[model samples]
Target: MIDVILADGFSMLTTTLILEALRFVNLAHRRKAFDWTIKGVQSQSPRASNGFTFSAQRSFEANAEPAELVFLNASYFPDAAASPELLAWLRNA
Candidate 1:
């Protein structure tokens, strides 16, 4: 499984491109070769710097099982106050 960890203000194009490539590969193979889950550091939906808001399937938690692969996508500076929690999760991950 592939996990997409989206940061606030993440690039829509970048996410789309990556997901599209995986989608194409699945089509070519005629099977679900790649499966992804979009997750947020917080429970709230993230809003991009360009004003694009998107929802995540789940929020990162310390006890949650890790995915086979993780994609970290961040396009803008994250709020300083929230960094520690994210950092801790990353460190543990």
Candidate 2:
């Protein structure tokens, strides 16, 4: 499965388009071509730069499931630097 680590303040358009394209491919092929887990740095929901927010399937701390592929999604101009906890998680992952 693909693990998508959506950083806080991610672009809504980027997230939507990627997921939509994946969904379309699955539908057209009539099979589960891909599976994804959207995760946040923590259990709290992440928000888009436009103030839109959504719940993640899991958090880095809460879930240790190994992933075949991992992706980081973040919008421009992040307000904060990557936390040490997140850096550690990435290193270990």
Candidate 3:
């Protein structure tokens, strides 16, 4: 299987959430087969509790905004629908 990475922006955007998940996943120390459903989201707004939320991290802080990837939680993404464009990018990246 050709495992090319997809939109780096998307990956970068999710890095924090995913890495945190990975750490928790590893620490669990058991081969669990599932995860709990996210709660408290009602709409498509970034402010929605269970959906993706993005914020710029450049204010006053020394880190450059473009260079900063911020993810506040794991429930940041919505349903995982594999679109054709995403597949293409993953295959070609």
Worst 10 residues of 3 by lDDT: 1-10
Compare the candidates by lDDT and give the number of the best one: 1
- What is residue 65's positional error in candidate 2, in angstroms? 4.1
**Residue pair clashes in candidate 1:** none
For all candidates in order, the CA lDDT equals 0.76, 0.75, 0.32
TM-score of each: 0.81, 0.80, 0.25
lDDT (Cα, tens digit) per residue for candidate 1, span 1-93? 987877777788888888899999999999999999988765548666677888888876656776888777776665622577666766665
Question: Which should have the higher lDDT, number 2 or number 3?
Answer: 2
Tell me how candidate 2 scores on lDDT.
Answer: 0.75
Candidate 1: minimum summed lDDT over ten consecutive residues — where?
A: 77-86
What is residue 36's positional error in candidate 1, in angstroms?
A: 0.8
Question: Comparing 1 and 3 by lDDT, which wins?
Answer: 1
Predicted candidate 3 versus true structure: per-residue lDDT over 1-76, tens digit per residue: 1111112123344445554575587568676423322211122222323234434221111121211232223232
Candidate 1 positional error at 84, Å: 3.6
Cα lDDT tens digits, model 2, 3-93, are: 7777878888888887888789899999999898888764458887789887899776633755787776777744353777766666766
Number of clashing pairs, model 3? 1
Higher-ranked by lDDT: 1 or 2: 1
